[model samples]
Target: MVMSLLLALPLAVGLWLVTGGRALAVVLARRITAATAGATLLLAVATVAFGAAVDRAWLPELGVRWSFGVDGISSPLVLLTAGIGVLVALHAWVEVPPGGSPATFLGCLLVVEAGALATFAARDAVLFLVAFEVVLVPMWVLVARYGDAHDPRARTGAAQRFVLYTAVGSTTLLVGILLLVATAGTADLRRLADQAGAGLGSGTQLAVALLLVLGLAVKVPVFPLHTWLPPAHTTAPTAGSVLLAAVLLKMGTYGLVRLPVSVVPDGFARLAPALAVAGAVGIVWGGLVCLVERDLKRLVAYSSVAHMGFVVLALASGSDTGLQAALYANIAHGVISALLFVVVGGLKQRWGSVDLAVRRPALRETSPRLGFVLLLGLAASLGLPGLAGFWGELLAVYSAWTPAGDRPRVVFVACAVVAAVGAALAAAYALRVAGLVWAGDRPDPEAPRTPDTTGVERWVIAVLAAAVVALGILPMLLLSTTADAVARIGGAR
Candidate 1:
């Protein structure tokens, strides 16, 4: 019952929001989305609290099931998805994308939520893949349709890139899944996890792992394959950016860990060294790019490349500590990134543009709320200790320095050093962005004073701020939940 409600309820709400008589109405859409998302949030909380895995066979003949469950690793992400769904719905209620009916925008948002919920809950390989694909369309719609209207063509182009890149990843992912099923003789993730690569040969495992990773990597946007992310984030609506950063990106990293690293141990071991190196490059590249970027949202988008690099490093490290850090970092990035986008979006909403040079003084003096939230986001994002963001990077680097699996020490250590440098660059850019927004004289003193955050916006910022601090102060809250599961998956060093 709980598993069913967690996925079905939000999807049902999305359906009604898109098709009901009042589907076109903003207030109705908000009411319905809020009510349903709120319920889903509770269900997610319950799932985490129980920490039980549930599997109900749905396609017995095809070796699939309507399996849905949460462990220490997945529970936190499921919770993050649900909480953000409510926040996104609430935030959208007031800040509907320009030139669209409130119903359509909010409805698509709900659908994204439903897809994300299902993705996080999936326990079988086939189910995970299906839920994974479910999220693409609505997200594409958000990017292509309700994107930055000023550059319609750019938005359309970004949407195309997103679709093309992700589509290729999906094709590769399907092949990987089929390969795993053929080699392992089942698509059941639980069974595979138990097998621990016993039945598959090293060659078969490597081939399957490469294909699966190729699919998930494009989604994770690992370095060379990450070109699609910035443009998509830049063009997407605020809700789209939030969801993309917060939940959608996690799907890729999560899948990589849950699928390849967990099920194909020998294959993952083969890829670990190179994977760590790629992650290192992404970390450095993302940070360096952020330093030069002038567009606030795009800078944040690139920062994701750097940040998720930590998660990638952690997974490649293949130690309990590294996996734990990756999980922690994944959730922390989701919260911090969403907060950054909200503040950036708010700035754009008011200033008509987020050209840091043009909208310098308005944010801090005109609206201290934005200023304050921006500062918090910057501090948390720069891997400040006692904040949620610190643990993931710190542990990932440590794990890399002293990797658990039998990978090359030189490679992991070199990558670890590079990631640490990336962390410093991250600080440089985070502070730099905050300084641009909060410091300096008014570039446009007479450009009309933009209004500050509203009551709802203030509340939203406060809640997210509290979450960042809470996780930072009590990092164990997440670490405790994920430690056992990650240890179980990789056997901590």
Candidate 2:
């Protein structure tokens, strides 16, 4: 019951807003959305605290069930999604992008949140895929209809690319899920994991792993599959950007863990070397792009590619420590990326553009608060000590340096070396951003001053910044929560 309400609240409210409530006044819409988001967060907290679950028959003929629950593995993600939903809703008080009615925009955000929540909580293979698809159309609406008002064509193209790419990935993912279900003769994820691909032959497991990995890699936006990301991030509204960075990208990584790593371990092991290579390349590639990327928002987007590389590399290591590192890095990136996007998105909104190449007044001089937060986010991004980003990257490299016995040591070690270089690249770009935006080009007293963050925006950034600090200071807060579940998944004794 509690689980059901948690998923249904945002979804039901959002559906109404999109359809019957489209004419709601802007302020009214925002208030309602904020309230709905807040209630959903509370429900999420209760559900996680109480270990709430719901499982029942949904399709007897197909052997599917309506199952939703949270464990150590999913609890954090559920909380993050619900919390971010609230933040995005509060952000509506700050700015509503001009491409659509306020109600419709807010509705889309709620729906996306609900979808992400459902995705995280789903306990059935087919249900996971279904929940995954729930976010697609709403996210498309966000990028297409409520994106950058200045360039409709670019927004449209980005939206089209987002849908087209992910649509293909989804179709592929569906096929993979069907194959897994048919072979395993069960749709329940818990049973599938318990079986651990026991009855399936190596060839079948490999085939399922390939399809699942390929399909999810696009959503994770792995190196070669990540081209659609920058454009979408570049043009999305601030709220949209936050969800994209913090919430949407995570679904892919989580799916990789839930589907491939846990259910098809042998096949994933066979593919680990290749995944390690791709991850290492992405780390360097994204950093190189960030070093030269002129657009601030896009630079941040590219940085996501780099950060997520660490996650992929960690997961490919195939150790208990590796899985823990992957999960830790996943959450860390979500918080840090949300902080960065919120700051960068706000900058873009105020300046009408965020071209780092163009000389501008110092953020420190004009907008000290924003400047401070920007520096903090950049510091965390570069893996500064005592910050959220440091431990995850550290663990990731360490895990890769010493992977599982079955993994090719030489390949993983080489990947670790490359990842270290990528870490250095991250530092270079972080300082570059700090110097260009935070420090300013030259002391120009006459230059136009960008307004500092205030009100709801200031509060939102502050809360996220605090979370980064808290996570950094107490990494165990999340690590311990996930430890038991991770051990179970890794077959740790």
State every prediction's TM-score relative to the real structure.
Answer: 0.97, 0.99
lDDT of 2 by residue, 391-493 (tens): 8999999999999999999999999999999999999999999998988855467767799999999999999999899889999999999999998987821
lDDT of 1 by residue, 142-187 (tens): 9998999888999999999999999999999999998898778888
Runs in model 1 lying further than 4 Å from the true structure: 21-23, 51-54
The residue pairs found clashing in candidate 2 are: none
Ten consecutive residues with minimal summed lDDT in candidate 1? Answer: 16-25
lDDT of 2: 0.93
RMSD of 2: 0.9
Best by TM-score: 2
